[model samples]
Target: MKYNTILFDLDGTLTDSRPGITKSAVYALESFGFTDLNPDELNFFIGPPLLDTFMQHYGFKEEKAHKAIAKFRERYNVTGVFENSAYEGIHEELRKLKEAGMTLAIATSKPHDIMLRVIERYELAPFFTAVEGSKVDDTGYRKSQILKEVFEDLHTTDLSKVLMVGDRFHDIEAANDCGIDSMGVLYGYGSREELESYHATYITENVSGLAKEILTCE
Candidate 1:
């Protein structure tokens, strides 16, 4: 269970971006004349790609999904992106991992530029060795694709020594596809049932638990 490298998912695993994402989603829905879209009901937007969320949750066609994404970015890029906060103890956990000599990286569905802004704003840029994310153009939104890019940037072939930590089924599934282990956190948007169904290697209820699991791993 030893790992030398850890890939993190940005939105839920490290930071609580629910407010920003939900607000932006509501803005997008409003643009389509759906003024009643509840921000609380938009929790599904936290982990997955915007395009998929728009289509899957709202029944938007591909073309309309793209448009909705644009509208989301219009607000998100200005206000929503900054409307986020790091989870409690996340900084301490990351510092501990870094001090232990583990390489850390970010693999997120968020666009690369925006992810960078978020990380930098939160002062998390120092801990991660690399950050790979989807493009603003909406390409490379799949967790698997994002992780592939992260692995490529890392230039590491030993998947056994790599661990991906996230809060969604997509993260675990992507780790499985990449031949790596994964840890799911419950303090984020995803449910325990979802993580378990995806066969995550481990699940933790909070940042402290997650830190303990990572530090104690073989």
Candidate 2:
């Protein structure tokens, strides 16, 4: 294998979490007095940090954005979390990678507390060597910071042998910033143009193809 360690994103990558997230987003936006938001419109919320997304897209200031995040969690923790489902073939491929002795881990913007719950709910804890997620505080931890912590947890500094895999520009951009290769998956939320624009080292559209890419040298 060309890479010894692989980092996977949570939302829109391993699982289709839109229903959960957008539904909860509805709850939050409604609480913020914006009632016309289409759940479809919240697709951008799938991969990025809620604080920044709200501030950037909805014009929320930091204080109001923090409250919106709280409202998001209010519903998300109770119901929105379980509204997600894993993609077909992902679990089997993750098993294939694990059995092949590759180090697998999760690096997600989902808050650390909630990420733990979601991982257990989806039964994905067994395959990973390390799992890192964003803090539940008011801060939106950058993907770069999250990946840096992941590298430390995995005890690997050879960025050449590491791969970051996800379905968003944020994931690829962070890998680029951290000097690691990245694989952008189209089966998730990101488009080929989005991934290519960010210069992902590899791109695939399905979990099986992703497995082939990982297990093969080229």
- Residue 143 of model 2 has an lDDT of 91
- Model 2, position 70: C-alpha lDDT score: 89
Which residue pairs show collisions in model 1?
A: 2-218
RMSD of each: 1.3, 1.3
Q: What is the lDDT of candidate 1?
A: 0.89
What is the C-alpha local distance difference test score of each model?
Answer: 0.89, 0.88
What TM-score quantifies how close candidate 1 is to the native fold?
0.96
TM-score of each: 0.96, 0.96
Candidate 2, residues 49-109: lDDT per residue as tens digits?
8889899998999999998988998999899989998888889899988888899999998
- Candidate 1 residues lying further than 4 Å off, grouped into runs, are none
Give the CA lDDT, 0 to 100, for residue 178 in model 2. Answer: 95
